[model samples]
Target: MKRSDGLKMKLVDTYTMERVVAGSASRYPKRIALRTYAEEGSELTYSELKRKSDAVSLYFLEQGFVKGDRIALIGESCPNWMLAYFGLTGIGLTAVPVLPEFSPKEILHILQDGGVKAVVVNARHVEKILPFIRKKPEFLIRLEDLFHIPMPISGELKDRNQFLNAPGRDITRRKVDAKARQLLSEHRPKEEDPASLIYTSGTTGMSKAVMLTHRNLVWNADISSDVYFKVKPGYKALSILPVSHVYEFTIGQVLALLCGCEIVYLGRPPAPSSLLPALKEVRPHIIMTVPLLIEKIYRSSVLPTLKANPKLQRYLRFGITRRFIFRIIGRKLIVTMGGRVRFFGIGGAPLDREVEAFLAEAKFPYALGYGLTETSPLISGGKPKNHTVGVIGKIVEHLEVRLEEKDPATGIGEIAVKGPSVMQGYWNNPALNEEAFTPDGFFKTGDLGFIDKKGRLAIKGRTKTMILGSGGENIYPELIEAVINNQDFVTESLVIPEGGALVALIKLDIEAFAEKMALSVNEAKSEAARYLNKLREEVNKELNVFSRLSKVHLQEDAFERTPTQKIKRFLYLRKKDESSDA
Candidate 1:
């Protein structure tokens, strides 16, 4: 299949990670490959990166590690982490990237499941995995130590006599280099070989290790670069998403490397305070983020300001006036976002419609993407210029996507996909493998949506989250929650069914509400009942009849969420049921 750009999708049957690193180094040796945002942050050129990775590979080989050996990499995103990944995978070993945010138990489960033989970890993560040390894998090396140790320049000249015998030194050096290259080539993994064992973030259920082969990752990177990204060599990308997540691993790291782009990894979590300075310093050309971060910026920075200004709010009702006004505001937003971002890729979850509309009006370069870890994380996405609000743009090249088991009237169905990027299957879990795929081989995505007349996909909700109304109508809680979340003083919300009645669990912005009302916390709490009643009535006005909330409950704490900041709906649903019975 050829992409819309006329580039044919050719799956390489024998492509390997070793070739990828070597090709990049050969093509752009002097190019800045990666920059980190740590206190003593540094940048690495392609040549340096290739050399360090080779050194690490040689070290592993010296330790008797060979093909198919599993190595665990657990740490925050850093240059050493990438080197370790490249080194291990270049020598045909499986790299298991454990999320740094995982609890000790979660980490142990993954290490055990993969039978990880060695681990490369940051100092911060050592204590967490100490319990597993006794059940020893071959080695446990610290990432910082690897970064400080330099690779040998001349393969360790033994004594002064060997040093003085310099007539044949140049030939010896060439021979040593050739031998190292040969060793790497001998162990190079095939396209079908498992390159990574990535565990899902488990927003819906327990985490499962997803086995992605070299072909699955490389092909996805090729297609993404050709179709969705169009990133040029020397382009700069700010990477804030966790590297362990397949979304970031492939698009943020692999695709960046493939295009010879310089990636800047934020040392700290991308909280606004830290992120603002990093953005200014890096001035990245592109950014890959989840909806939660952008939505928070919209709610905290954009929404409140607009709501406070009546004239601006009224102007927003008209297209021309809104665009003109937002243009000025958007310029400021661009400056705040490093002043050079050509593309802001939003994924992980569906973006809020209000936020998307604002970005469109402001002419912000933000694109919506849709996919899951099972599909190497990108099933569909488009450039900012082609973005349609509420639509997850066209299907990506080389993939077949369909809406299965559609309703005759609404045309909604589960989004199923078949492509090379899809995983081999859940690791060692035959039951899940059988349940995950249809008989014909499409991987069931478990999302509910319909393709519009223009062929753009719009998600209604997750199939697991859809509620049945009392009158047997389908109610998408996400749609209702979006409305509720847009209301004044609401931070976030979750809508669930209870005793045949729709209930909303809301976490209010208490501090903001109290400040707005000019009341103390005690006073705000005292009057919350009356305020919540009015808030519920206001939200109902924006929702459909079937999706209206029967009652609203104020949640004292924020809802438990996954690593991606998606609310753990299962946890809240269980709690809601328990409360209803109480």
Candidate 2:
């Protein structure tokens, strides 16, 4: 890409990975495409990335893998992982990106369901697939350097590292023959071809592989560029979310490539110690993360400081002064986050109202987005400066979105969408495919929401999770939980229906409670139990009468969550006999 300082970028015709790679390589071959935040020599230029991916593609073709074959990609987010993904997709093979956090059983299920003929994985995740050797693929390639890892000696699983170190053939080592080079140069996949088969992290405790075509992925990335803030060549983007999630893959990776931006990946999880230093080092112009990350920062750091100061707490009662004070703190936060961030995209789950209010008042550049794995992940979003506090931005261009079976009183209903970015269907599941879309071909999002008068989308809750009140009113557990979560000393909360009444399972900030009260763990637990009723009363005051909590219990264990940090509601909706109530 040209410097993009004052030049206009010509749009590409095809919406395939091959076209994206070729265009970038031809325009900005020397531009740094990908790198690690902490590592020294882990950078790949656009030219190098294209060359490496092409070599992997040639190797697979030589191995007799034809078009439409499924290949599983399992590893942490790294350049090599992208290389393998691009290689597979560029050669017309479907790339199934699996999350590294999946259990052994989950990984095996995905491998079996995806019909993966081969697996490209790093050594870190090799153990997840070791138990199901009989049903797993025979061809294994190490993701670190694109070397083929042969099966273990005696066809038995011994050590994962032995398989990692004992490389049989290096894919890049073989010379490219004339015919192979010609074939690779001539090969082109159609825009409608399936580029990625993504298995969603189901919060409902069921998984399905969502097949996203080349057009779905690329077109979404292209349109999203117009939705978010503008970026020039060489702009830095720090990626913290799991790339296996469509939210990160399309917005963080593909969108950066389209803009000629350099993507920096964290070497480890984005904990404070590591992420703070990386923020200072990279000084990223863009960041993609889920709401939990920012909500933690606000709850742990920002909220306490404001409340602890007596004069500031008094001043916070006034609107004008409070916003000024928040802006000052927001400037400090910007400095803490490398002082150069322009677009901070938050998605995957609903952001807390308190945190969102603070962000808007503080002038923090935070954009809220709403989507799912089925719609190529971006149904509505906007630039931070253009974002409304309680609403996700307008639907992207070229998409038709409407509320289905909207309530006359509340105006909330299931969000149905139809667009080029929508996925083809659930892979190999005819029953689900039939139920997922309407007769007119609109994909039912399973979410309850409505379009505002200002043309923005506001999400209410999921259809399955909505509880019916005794008087036939709708009670959204998420809205009640949001109130509970914003309470003092509350870390997280879950609201469920028990015996026709809403009950809240609350997890307290034990360490904070212990520190403040100078109490031991047992004493803190007792103290928290005593405070639950008061906490329930406080939360109920912010909610409607029907949505009020009937009981509040101290949950000792943390609730299980999906990759996006959404509490798995199905896991907690237990039988009355199976209740672990405290």
Candidate 3:
């Protein structure tokens, strides 16, 4: 397929991570493949990446680890994380990447459920795994230095620190010689072999391990980089989202590798203090993120700055003038984002309405993607030029997508898909596997959406979160929350059913509220209550009667969210009789 740059991407002989890395190495041996953002001398070329990954594979084999064994990777995004992932998956091991943000209990559940035999952990996250080290895993390799972390007292597991500490061939400095390469080649996984086992974030309180095969991941990365986005060889990609999530792993890391683009990892959270400087240093050509990041930027910086300008406020009242003003602001935004970004990909959750409008009118290179981990996370998306405000764009190439049980009036229904990228099934859960797919083989996405007249997909909300109104009408909390979130002083919101009526829980922008009211936090809290009640009345006028909130409550804390910034609805689904207060 011809990519956006008009270059033809040759079909891979085998759909596997090994093939992807090997191909890039052979094609661009001296090209920088991975590096830490703003850290000089930390770069790895394509050939170097391949050799290091090979060394990692041989190191695992030398430790008595074998293919098909689940190896857990717990860490922030970094070059070492990619090396460990490629090393394990290339040698036919199932890569079980645990989110570093997961609690100790949650991490334990994943390690136990996946039957992880080995763990490649970041030093910072080792405390979370220390208690469970005796339960299942027999090996611990520190990710920071790529050395064996010695554990004592139990003495039940082999101590491989000696091998890593060896003078001639240390773990980090080891070279995969011909003999080691030959041994590693013997374990090359087939296309259908499970490459990674990813656990869902559990917005509904039900987490399951999703088994994605080599073909599932490779094919998605192949088609996505080749047919959908415009990323060129030698282009720089700045990755911000957690690589543990399929949305970033497939599109950001793997696809960039497939395209021979240099990937710069933040190696830390992308906070303004660090990320702003990294942007200037990297000057990346591509960036992938979730909606929360951009939405926060819009709410905290761009929107406030624009609203505070009295001149732009009057200009923003007219459609043409608003777009023109946004265009100028977008140019500044591009410069702030390193002055060289070609594609700004957004997914993991729906983009807010106001943010999407600003991006669209400003002609920002912001793209929207929609899918679940079950599909290798890319069902529909497009370049910015083809994007509509609310729609997620056209279905991806070679995928069959249909709306199941469509509503004649609204045209919304469950999104069902069949494609090469669809997952094999949930790990060790046959019942869930059966229920996750249609009888004919399509994966039931469980997301409610409709294809617009332009053939673009517009997601409504999760079917699981849809509340049935008194008159049996479907009230989508996300849609209502989107509207509420667009209002001033509102940072985020959730709509839930209580006492047979809809209740709105809002998290206010404390600083903004304080500044606006010119009061201390304690005083602001009381004012916030009055403001929320007024906000609810105003927001209700824009919503349908059945969807209107019966009561507005101040949520003192931010709602507990999944990694994707989606609220864990199951946690707040129950009714509460407590009075509304900050």
Candidate 4:
């Protein structure tokens, strides 16, 4: 198949997960394939990665694990996590990646629901799974001990190094290595065979496991590598998002390996302190992040400076001057971001219009993508050169998409898609599977949006999140929240329906507001109330009548969010009765 770059690429249908790694290993054997940032970081060449994965897979095979056996992998993003994933899926085992951020109950539910037979977990989360180990899986293996351990049977061998050096270990490793070679030479996974089961973060409700085959994931990666960005050999990518999410797994890890990019996994959270150093050290070529990360940077760094300087603010009103000023600032931002970034890909949520505008004005090479885990996550996206602010550039190559139940006035409706990259269905849930697809086989996205004349997809909101006004008008809270979030002193806001009126729960920058108003803590709270009322009047004037917020309430605490940093609307929805006054 030909990629958008005019490169002739092998179709995913012709290969399996094992072949994907083997092909890359042959091509970039000595190249640094993966790196992990810890107290002392580690690096692995493509050949070493393949060898370590083979050794891990050998242990699993020796322990009686077979093709189709489901194994759960739970940990933060790291080299071992990827190695375990490749080790499992490379041999046809179905890997279930559970987010480390999930609660213990949530983790238990996934383990039970997926019917996981064995688990590969990090030491930190081992305690959370220990209670359920006797009841759920057959055995557990620690990721840190993956290299030293001989077999993964529970209570079998306590000494890892001793076991590795033992004569029995040598026999098992030799046998497993031979079997691995034989399988690679003689057997390969079918395109239809299940590869991984990814559970959604469930921002709204209970999470469902989405089953993706080797073809579903590999095809998405191959197509994206061709069309999304230029793939330069030795390109460096700093993976900040959780690898458990399909968005990061396929694009950040798998696609990067396919394109021969060296991936550096941040051992710590992507907070400014940790991220800044990694950026300087790695000097990455690409960064795959969610909108929240970039938005925070803009809010804390750019917005404050622009707001304080009247001269710069006036210059921003003129396009020519704005570009010149922003270019200088953008260059500094790029330096702090490790200097050589060609692609700043944002997904997992909508980018704030103001933040995106700043990026466009600065000429930052930023791209936006829209998708759900069901589609293996890339429904629409494009290169920065072709990007249009506020639009998810265009439908990706080889996918068929359409709108259902379109509203005549707005042309907005549920998005439905059909493509090889789309998942088979929600695992073990026939009812959900039935509802997830149209009779014609298009997967129902449950997201509301309209395609522009130029083929750009501008999302309106989620079907489940749209608020019904008192007069029966449709209100998109996200649109109203965007306006509120852009206001001065407002950090974040959530618009919800309360007693048939739109009430906003806002988290204000109390410290900043107090300093700006020259008020004490108690006086600041009172002043904030008055400011919110006045701000409400101003915001309502900009929004449509039906979408206007009736009241703005202050939230002392931040709104609870999902692993992906999406506000858990369902949690706040039920707590409307407990609404506090501003």
Candidate 5:
């Protein structure tokens, strides 16, 4: 691959990327910095963003919040949420972002786990933990109270009453944004100083607070931008990803802000109808999505029509539709998506192959990435091609990646990364941190990947989650799920080991299968399950002896997913039979 035009960008150091974001804020302060889609399509622009963030920082200073204090911004997506985050970190304090979907117990655990001193939580979610607020009144503060507001207008104030009530409208609370900025001008944060304490979704165990510094976030974004798509100012972006996750924060919020993109934040998780309409309304050029979403879109929306007509799918395989029927289907999707989505970046989980092919046929720019919280969630990412099949992408500049075992093999092994984007290590868990990193400093990614001859990284599975066998062989559940999910009737599949044997808990597309069978909904499920069982048996025959499934559980409900759309694996660990061998 060679540069074609005069558009080559030098691989920037982490320091420069941070300077660029802050500097860009100053240079383009009045630009449409961010847009928060609220009730009935309400939005807030860049100037409003700057003003609110400034006021919040001032309020923090007024409240006597010291530097390094972890200010938890707990809420669903909103403009004020972003304001509080920037205000906290812009002044050298750590931002602890919590997803609003978290259980009250989980929220309390993280808020306490991070030792959050100040909380700027959404009012809507306040009552969920209202009972516990009195115990920590000093730290429990609502979002509306954080920004400097006018003295509680004593008269009839309806829309403003929400701000004037409990944990709100404290005009004298402390106007600190100006003071914090002044302090920032005097003593700024080094790249290494902890800036955010993001907790992993904890699908496996108690969520670990992954400490990321300014350097890590900024550097990782820079690499992702350069390698994936060099985002420019005013780049239209759709941000459906939750800001609490590392991928969404770095790529969706921080990166979008750094690039000066006007993100169309959907207040809710995007449904096809709502998403298509919003796409037409926003006309965004970029979209950050999880693999599961992309796969679903292709399977439920695109693949059915293709499979109905084998001749049409064959034509689609060539990137050209022969019949008018085929063209109509293709054009419908393109037009529905606003006909301008150039980069549909996918991550957070593995995509089903059939869905991937459908997207490719429809000419979707569905790039994939692979990484974990420790590396700021970006180890490799890029455009997909044949040689890059299932490979994340070329290693970003300044990242040194090597396989732990370098002998005759499938060219796959644990991926260890050495870079500034690597975390300073888990907070207050030196024992875990010591085990997480290599002796020479390369952080263990826990992913097994092989660098292809073309230099792209292809992931096998997590080191911890890889199933062990009686003969001491390793089997990846993801590999088994890949085959199970590829079957036409299957919608999603999870390979769970039960009683010393693998079992695939599968969700089926009942309606589609029912229609195909020309049967009613009730009859279709029974027919689909029988057919799916046969499909599973066929797939199982190809697996290694240890990786074989003893049974197949047909699930009508979808697997519980994290905010980022990853299946909650820990929830299924107990469902496995306890009689299995060690």
Candidate 6:
């Protein structure tokens, strides 16, 4: 409850955080905790999780590993992801989570850069770090063993036998650094003590290690759960999203533990083929996903239905019985997501306005949020603005938000915040860390947003993505895209300033345009040029002075994306050979 700068902090009491969560087994011993991705398969429970955690704590003691020693948790999102982190935290250890998508070189960079001693990883992800074993033999430890609390009957290689047999240099050499580990065992990490170091994805620069204290992470889980999820006793979460990413990492792992929620993690991908079956079975109450997945449902399934029969769309939109049937289908979707999917959260990237509108009209409670990893990722999120539409929710309590350095006319600027959830600093990089915080201690979020008179915040774009105009004006490309995406047939749009004027690179709904033109699916797409000119005229008529696209550039391919599915605009910006005339 105490703070260094004398500012009062909203602390999630650790004892309370774990009380029900750790005792889930006794309370809901028969309830399912986690189910693998496979259909109708293995199920774990609260009691099982706690016992496994104890075994993990015992395993550390047996191995002579200490509290603060950094354990590389290399995997995406899964049941074991939660166990490794909480078991480490519960026993006073710090967890270092490595992303599954990292290339071999990048994985090596994280292991060597973090000075990690042991690793608890998915047997699948071990391959990514194999080449680095010879490079850092002393620090190597298998990530596969971190799944179960007790060693699985010894010599136990369910998925790891392949590694033992591979012809690589022996990794078990030299003494493991025991200082951090020892600190964990001797003294519990205080609220202010650093608990983990997350390396940023190097899309911007060399990945900087973010130093987050025990309080920093816990505080994020506490508030995010209360405001966004209202997480309560026996809450069930479908934990399939990659835990290496902050959004899933917190909800899929920390939030569940802090709220006594049952975490059902599938150690597999959530592609449509596998996801629907799991949903039909677990019937989880909570589901978290990015805009990409939701957008696909709209494009592939939802749109096709509306396209096949225009009357159906109109009938569903207006008729009472049809609306009831639609609600039933939505309810089934929610139930398949774990039965209580009251809150379907979409974050990490902006939601397309058309997709959001469809959900809103359909009466689906698909709430949206805005944030980056810099703020332990949860910033503002809630039900969409009905009257205004597309506004991000009000700022959560415990965090102070204000726009810093802006143009008043546009009412936009980079969002800056100060809160307990903010990280300690970037590890071992004081220069970058210093740049990250303002002179007054506010953390620079690099995101752009403006508050309405009624107090809701709407994110416009990232500060770095702002296009420098011929004059001094700042133009947000995403803002321009938002307007374009509102059009019914517009699938996705990206605004890239070319030759000092704003240009829109867009992908339209070919089938819809084809139907509008009375053409076959193939013919509709083949004659997309006619539709482009028509859509261009419509979009141009709709845009404001600063927001209007000077021209339109239609792209055949969707887009280049980061691992998290965010568009890599820099690639397009840096390419001199792009269709500049568009």
Best by lDDT: 2
Q: Give the TM-score of candidate 3.
A: 0.94
* lDDT, each prediction: 0.80, 0.86, 0.85, 0.82, 0.70, 0.67
Candidate closer to the true structure by TM-score (higher is better), 1 or 5 = 1
- TM-scores for all candidates: the values are 0.91, 0.96, 0.94, 0.93, 0.87, 0.82
- Show how many residue pairs clash in every candidate, following the order shown: 0, 2, 0, 0, 5, 21
| Runs of candidate 5 exceeding 4 Å displacement | 1-21, 38-51, 144-167, 170-184, 313-332, 384-387, 518-529, 541-546, 578-582
lDDT accuracy of residue 545 in candidate 6? 64
Where in model 2 is the C-alpha error above 4 Å? 1-10, 134-137, 151-157, 173-178, 575-577, 580-582
- lDDT, candidate 6, equals 0.67
Q: How does candidate 4 fare on TM-score? A: 0.93
Per-residue CA lDDT of candidate 4, range 405-489, in tens?
Answer: 9999999999999988899999989999999999999999989999999887889899899987778788899999999999998
At residue 381, candidate 6 shows an lDDT of 75
Give Cα distance to truth, residue 320, candidate 6, Å.
10
Model 2 residue 383 CA deviation (Å) reads 1.2
TM-score: the better of candidates 4 and 6: 4
Q: Give the per-residue lDDT of model 6 (tens digit) for 516-582.
A: 8899978877787666666767877776566667777767688776656777777777663454444
Q: State residue 349's C-alpha deviation in candidate 1, in Å.
A: 1.1
Clashing residue pairs, backbone N/CA/C < 3 A, model 4: none
lDDT of 2: 0.86
Candidate 5 structure quality by residue, lDDT tens digits, 1-582: 213421223333333223534555665676776665544434545655655555555656666777788878777776656767776775578988887778888888877778877667766676555444445556555564353323232112233235336333542234445655685455445667777898778556557778998878876775566566766778788888777788887877776776778877877778876777688888787888888776776677666766777777676555444434544655666567787776777888776665665555445566887778888878887773332346677776768899886435566688899876888889889988999888999998777888887788888887767888768777899888888877787878788766577778888888877887899999987776678678877997878778888788778888888877777887777655343333
Span of 10 residues, lowest total lDDT, candidate 4: 163-172
Q: Candidate 5: RMSD over Cα atoms?
A: 5.1
Better of 2 and 6 by TM-score: 2
